[model samples]
Target: MSNLTSHEVIILGGGISGLSTAWFLRQKGISFKLFEKQSETGGVIASEYIEGSVMDFGPNSLRDRNGQIRKIAKDLGISDDLIGISEAFKTRYIVRDGKLQSLSPNISSLISTKVLSASGKIRLLKEPFIEAGSGEDESIGEFLERRIGKEAVDYLADPIFSGIYAGDIYRMSKKSVLPKLAEFEQDYGSVSWGAIRSKKEKREVKPMVLSFKKGIQQLTDAITEKISDHITYDEVLSLKKSDSGFEVATEEATYHSLNVISCIPAYNLGRILEGFEPELSAELMNIDYAPMLSVQLTFNKAEIDFITEGFGFLVPRKERIRLLGAIWKSSIFPELTNKDQHQFTLMIGGAHDRGILTEPKEQVEQEGIREFCRLMQFDARPSVIRSRLWKKAIPQFEVGYEQQKAKLDRFEGGNPGLYFGGNYQWGVSVPDCIQGAEGLAEELAAGL
Candidate 1:
């Protein structure tokens, strides 16, 4: 007889999505065992303190767009550690004409901004007057080009969304990547009008870009602290539909549960469920993940030549640059650095540059530094340089994602006690993961 454990629910994976789901499910009085492959939790939310510098090996900042993450942190009793971005350093920049240019949220800023030419700015201004596009599935690049112009798509849409998804704008679905703008065209017949009306209806909540004083791992560690006993450090080998609910086999033992919530990545989850739900498994495998290289570099404050105000800049693919963009980590949260130390987390490899991940680390780092310095026209080498490679970092929301999502929904509905929730279908952010957890928690609570 195999070593077997039983529970009311079985949660797979130990990333933020899984932990958050487990946290909420437990609140609803659910009995579940969360099986994580890694010995420690926090999955990609890795943070470290080394050589007098605190750094997040994965996501450095968390955007509390829906305020869910903030509340979750407070509930976890780590609210006091939340460090908000410095108000003075909130300005965003983009590369244009081989120089860093300020990028404000206001569309009106385009009038005086050098990021776009007169023709491009005029084209952007005429967005309100442009007729709504045909309600059809379209790529973000195609959608923006139709509404604004090709110039805006290349300069604005390409780099901005690239920074987020690290994906090809021409392949990313507008409905999936940015559903709100797509909805604006469908409902209000004008993107600008929909934005204005939505703002008027809902109170303006400035989304906070924050990180923990210790690092992003604080929230994950705190979650694990509360539910430590319930988590099992074992890889789920496979899951199958069973008479009672589902049979989950792990490296250590076979666990039986009345319900199952899968929070694993699509790529891995597909393999685990392949023997059970082949069709859904096939769909899950269809999703694409972007490779990323997280390169952290620092310099002494006096060596920096350029203005270090606001957020960092994103490099557009059109510029023939290998780097995606970078963020000023020290500027955002002063606690992460030594006194007067300038730190930046530069990004390389994405949908476009998958090959860079396979190259020699020294060569790639050297090239990245050279390009970055030339672009900024600054003359200082980083005193501290650290690099981490993520093979499949973020899932790409490509065209036809809705169908892929619908298939999963069908699987969940067809199998009463089985469910799927993660950053794959829904948006990929700390807040999005939390939001998915809240929804799944309610769903499991009501159903079970």
Candidate 2:
């Protein structure tokens, strides 16, 4: 066996979380090494250029509500390359009665919008009267159904969260997944009232969905550039606690570190902790992941009859469509495609249709394309078709998530110099992952 290499801190998984954490540690002048199983970094963040169109295989864009994301971009020297979506893309669509319906962007339009029925809108008026309940965590569907109505849960919350997590809202925990909403309920006894009060308390900022000139991968690339030297391409086979700290064995060599931070998925981390922390491993192993597939297709502009407007439409389960949603990439970012072509990214196979992930890739693509054509009223064959399947995509914050969180807390407390930070810990968004990394880096730096 090769002699064990040593580092002050070791990061497992070279995804955005790992790369961003390494960048922050380097900024603090802390010593660390990042190990990735894959040959290249970025994990699922992949940008592909086909002919003249640029397609993002993973996340299309990020919501930068706070300036932290912009500061990171500036630090990476890629702020100049940051591109914000057009104001015209503010509108979002949802499938209703097998047709695309635009959601109102303003209060007046919301009252008049056909997305929800008159009875549903009237039910929303009684939201402030709904009594808040105190108890264990509830599913997002259950919470929304109680606060608003079943109509809202079916029409609004379902499609929106499906687009975000590709998860089943009925199984996802309300407090764990949507903490802000839960806080609103707890603070004011009504989500609607709390939202209004909170909005008045805070200054309004224009919402921006941002990406790089090339793609979201630019953010990962810039971070990797800063910390490339400290990265090792190897799969972590096992992790065991030692007297000094922890020893991590990878395919290439074993490494010793005073502190170990895991940026990998929950299931992968569970495998590494099997013998060392069986209880924690059991909890981690129970974390459910939803399978998702992103299908990118290009068509000649003249071949499509429907106008590609706003972002795109999300398919509510009521629509009984195999597709979860589709993002109009060319419309959102004009630079992503050639002037003569339009690009669309269709998402398929969430918790509702996980079996799609097991089917042949060709069948999945065909089904997605068929749904896309049916939804958009297009008949012309796509000029280009490509697909990427993530068997374990987004982690589900299912019922009893608080128990798992408690387990993580206990494990962290019991095992010193061990930390866990990833999309699974905080959130599934790009900004959320970056923020978690920043916080973890600060904690580790402070301890050092």
Candidate 3:
């Protein structure tokens, strides 16, 4: 495997992180190549076309807080392509009293919503007086319970938590997963006080929720279009240190580059770099990854009894459902919907119960239908169902996450020409991944 010529920079993995890096390199007019294991780009960001309706298998929306993502959209001349969710649909729902109940929509609802009992409401008032201990880190469940109450944590936060991370708040790290909560403890000494401070600071804050008018994949596709010529659709077998730079090996050919950026999934990265740095590889391999399964269903609008105007619903783990949450895709964006057809994207099998991910396709589909009917009260099956299983998508930021960061620090210090940056290295959202890529690009530019 000693055939291909070297380049200025070589990026492994062709997900959003890798693509964004390539895009930045193009803007800098630096020569580079991007290698992807898949035949096409967009690793987890994929969409399906069913009967003229666009359905997404991953990431239905991007938050407005994602400045990097917003900047990228603006730069691509597609900033106007963004869409906002409806106000009525702004309220989330949870299973309470064996029925779907609307959560607090606004400040008035927070004070009036029956989802919280009188005792729970009063318990929350005590949050302003509750004392947070001085500790390095704690679980999200523990932190929430300490700040508010168990009901607030279990009812208000748990369902949303389950839907987003498929992680048990009891095990998830508060410092790493929910740093805003940590910041509240640090600056205000109490979350209630932090809320007051945050309100005054809210004007400086940008929009906190958003999505592309068409689909999330538009962002990935746009980035790829900006750097399509430099990408390679080949599987990289291994990487090794060379006399001057680094050697990257694919099945049929080998290529050397002045600098290497490993953007593959954490687990995969660990294996590929094992021979080079066993200790760092071992630490990286220990970084847990949760499987993700998304099922997109399309139905005639009349077939569904309830009219969905808002985003969707989430099922808590205690609900004992086989699915996580469902996003009313058509309601969120006009481009993804048709006049007569309605679509919903159901995400299931997160970090805690990925076992459901390996189930037979037919079984998963049937289970999804059952859960949908049971939770949302649909009478019949959806007209079209498409399921995509991603076994190594969600990165698990479990307790002691600093260990992973330390390993990365050691690896980078030992390997001069090799660099690594991806979703796992930073935060897990689209904005975080884009920021990580941009930061790495700047570092690479300075080195060049």
Candidate 4:
């Protein structure tokens, strides 16, 4: 058998995390090859252009203050193409009493919005007196209920969770998912005080929040152009110990590298490393993920109501709606839609709604359309249904997340050439993924 040559580093999985990792490695003048399972580089950042309108399958827009993502774009020479969400419509909404309601538009609005009950607002006043918990980890639901009362958790907080994680907040680990809140409790002894202190802390540094001028995929496309020939679309069939380093086998050939970064999701990691690292793989397999299906729809701009002029709205579980939320793509970024046609995107079925995604596609599509019409009060049905299903799209940071983190720590300590990073490893956000990539690159380079 002919021998394959080796590179200084090999990146597994072609998603943003892996691509970002390779992006930094390239800047460091290090030799590396990136392998993606699919032919494309962007994993969940897939965007579709229909009728001159932009539609997103995942991550419609990233926050503007994401310094790491923004810097990466600058390095890629696409910073000028980035755009911020319409400042006039940055506020989001939540569903309550089977109707779309505007959330607090301002600090003053918090006291006026009908989204929260009178008792709920009064209960929040007690936050300064509520004591913090002494524990390794706590669920997000528990934390909110203890601090602000169940109404805040159910209406204000839970709807936000529905949009972000699609996982129930009652089971999400506060320490893992929302570390800042956890830190707030630790330092100030009360969340209300923490918020007050946080304002002063934030004042010290100006935070920039925005998204790309084109779609987010533009950044990845630029990265791919830079490192075009170096990466391959070979799926890793198995991992094995080699004389010099490690070997990864694809269907057609085997590739060797001195160092490997496994950027694949936890579920995929479980499969590829099951034999090479059984115990570690088992622990990784236990990290439950949820499916996210997005339905992108296009409409006539004139048909939309004036109320639908914002980022969109999130539906809490109590609403009993199939969709988690809808993005007013046209309102937030009109470039995503044509001037004549209004563009909107909606998401449904997360870890909490596994049962929904498990059903047939036709059913999911119909359910999504029904929910969109009912919640957004669309004048007409969607002209097109570009439904995309992400099986095991994001990892759920359940209550026992620290134990899983501990297991990953031990696994990484033992495996020198292997590295893991993504939304699964860190908090689920564009900034977090970028931070995870940079951190992983430093770790792998140090080991080498």
Candidate 5:
């Protein structure tokens, strides 16, 4: 604990947030060190090569918005390895009445799609006429229902959003979950009209969703390569305010830094900050996370009769299913699997059902398989590559997120040289973290 070294900045956690922050900081030639409580740099962003398949136990893909992913990939000289979704496989499916129904956000498709009833479709058309509510934070579920009708919310919005945040829309904040949509409502008085106007004005392009050749971890690994010397693969025990600056005690040694930035999970950072900032720590702890169980398996094409293009299908809660959704990982990038082998990543449990993690793996797996097989109407036991349960996997931007956001903003003002920014502070996606890291790095570099 006595071995002390001074540095300009110290980064906590080596996930995408920490690594990306370090990459930008290193580019600025800022002297900083990153500490990760793991043997490797990537935290939840882990890739496993087993049975001729690249199984991503964490986020499977990166929806690159703001060009951050490509820019970083170019800077790392790995832009050549980037891949995107095949045009043929861009369809999305949602389960309704225990049947998988394709969702096409078009007038003709909306009228024909069985996911929403005829009346629901009529209500959807009425969105332009519906008056916008008073400006106030509301749940995503409520927002969607008020705008597009409840039927669409149940079959379309619910599962799609749940797939993203692993959260219940009824509890999650609309402002935090869909800021652009919320803004459109406030400015145009109708989300549908606002979207049409934005499109007419060519406001912005939808985010390009892509991933590296290896997996999502490739991005983290690339950043780690550039900043390898600056990272410590040791556990961060505690963080305290010291006479000099911020004192960080890790399992290996104690270090001091003039500036400290947290790129760790909210709960982890909360525990570390308990030593010096008890009130902020309490507030940080209040931010909740969703637990998830991801099962990746390989099925021989001959053994499965049903197969389709596009991303995957999500199981709406109304369908009375324990399975959350399954992504057609092989469809996204066939290179990740062997010839004639299809890989599917099944997700189970979320904010709605944390019990899946504690339940028996065999029972849960069987039930999930039973439901999936019923949907596919196939009878075959596929080879299970890997099944990993991620506890507190994704942060929930639930109701009252503003309070937490406000406190975090004030905390930085009250505490000098102490900054907190990560997925918890901005977004949970890889691109979101990268985008946030870029802005935060520039801000920190200027301050330094």
Candidate 6:
């Protein structure tokens, strides 16, 4: 409706990536503005407090590995609020034969675990003998099957990727998602050999899984407070390359900036660039996302007969259950709820279960509850239930993803003052977004 004065740089979207970029830019004494469509920031990282229970609508935790996140926390003055996961959560389970089985990592434990069949265990021992394939991209399923056998793909790789990406194992690119595994095969001729040799080389500090005393939103809130003066609550309707730089239009006003860092979803970015750069937009459109549902259920700890130890269990595709997996929220972080209650966060509907989203909420919830009861053999009902549907939750790093990524990188290289950052570009984890943002900010600030 009107024109606003141009700024030096405009960072679009107010999620962790965008916000962190702005924070980093501010440290360099650069002039910038942040545009967020929502009244509040943090994107899917939302938290709610209800009746003494803390519920996270999005990510429940973050893995603090390189201390970058801890430094961010310290810088934000919320280091005291950081909480580490319990030691008891070190154990994880996998569903097998309608029962929860312990997932063991070492060879001795793998031989003794009941999760895999005797034949499957035998197949695993053959991994070292299997020859590595040509240096071409392959799906996770294909890579696992080729190296470790089909049993590992069915019981191990499938559920793990499902939990992380809510993705299809047969479609997920091994090079893009699990580069280390790919490298092991290429460098050592076998994953097992590579792993063994790697262990002998050196030991790296393990990353601790963590969260804030309140929730992950605490981090976002802290960043928002630090950069409050630079943020504006306005929706960006469209974008066009201008003589000066770029003209970003909102519903009520237009603003021009010499540089722009788009940190929105891939689909949103594709739409925004449709008119200006159709070819780039077409490449962006190729990036697909998986829909997911996060359902939180609270139950009286005393009434439930099942033991709620460990982080929770993942269901294999062969299980034929609508539910993908459930996280033992209370067990992971006791502060999330009172002593009398245990909370479970269940994830349902992914690439394969897309139809479940269209089903009535009541029906879906009831079905999930029934399935959980049948699997875990629990007879009690949840005292409280909360659910949120994410239509485009996790980006699928499917086969041929590198091509599209390379195309976007080339587009940014060819076009000056246009940059891209988000979960879609580098990775989907909280730390990945922050690290990518920090790097992007440094590059952009240097260019200025």
Using lDDT as the yardstick, the better of models 1 and 4 is 1
Model 3: pairs clashing at backbone N, Cα or C within 3 Å: 64-208, 64-209, 89-310
Across residues 183-296, which tens digit of lDDT does each residue of candidate 3 receive?
888788887688778777644446656667557888898888878888888898888888758988887688887799988888888888888778777888988877877888
lDDT of each: 0.84, 0.87, 0.79, 0.79, 0.85, 0.86
Cα deviation of 155, candidate 1, in Å:
0.5
Task: Output the lDDT of residue 437, model 5.
Answer: 88
Predict model 6's lDDT versus the native: 0.86
Sliding window of 10 residues with minimal summed lDDT for model 5: 198-207
Q: How accurate locally is residue 86 in candidate 5, as Cα lDDT from 0 to 100?
A: 65
Using alpha carbons, what is the TM-score of model 6? 0.96
Off by over 4 Å in 5: 1-7, 201-207
Tell me each candidate's TM-score.
0.96, 0.97, 0.93, 0.94, 0.96, 0.96
Regions of model 3 farther than 4 Å from truth: 1-7, 202-205
lDDT of 2 by residue, 302-343 (tens): 877657668988988877888999999988998778889999
Q: After TM-score superposition, what is the CA distance of residue 303 in candidate 6 from its true location, in Å?
A: 0.9
For model 6, the stretches where C-alpha displacement exceeds 4 angstroms are 1-7, 199-206
lDDT, candidate 6, at 324 = 91
Please give the lDDT score at residue 47 for candidate 2. Answer: 95
What's model 4's lDDT at 179? 82
lDDT of 4: 0.79
**Tens digit of lDDT per residue, candidate 5, span 1-448?**
5433555689998988889889999989988888888888887888888877888989988877657678789999999989886653567788888888886656777778888888988998899889998769999999999999998899888898789889999999988888889999999989988888877754254667787778888888888888898888888889998888889988878888779999999899889889878998898888999998888878888888756576788988898899999888888777777777888888898999989868897778778877877886768888764788888899999889988889888988887888898898879887778888889899988886
Each candidate's clash count: 1, 0, 3, 7, 1, 0
Which pairs in model 1 have colliding backbones? 89-310
Give the better candidate number (2 or 6) by lDDT.
Answer: 2
For TM-score, the strongest prediction is 2
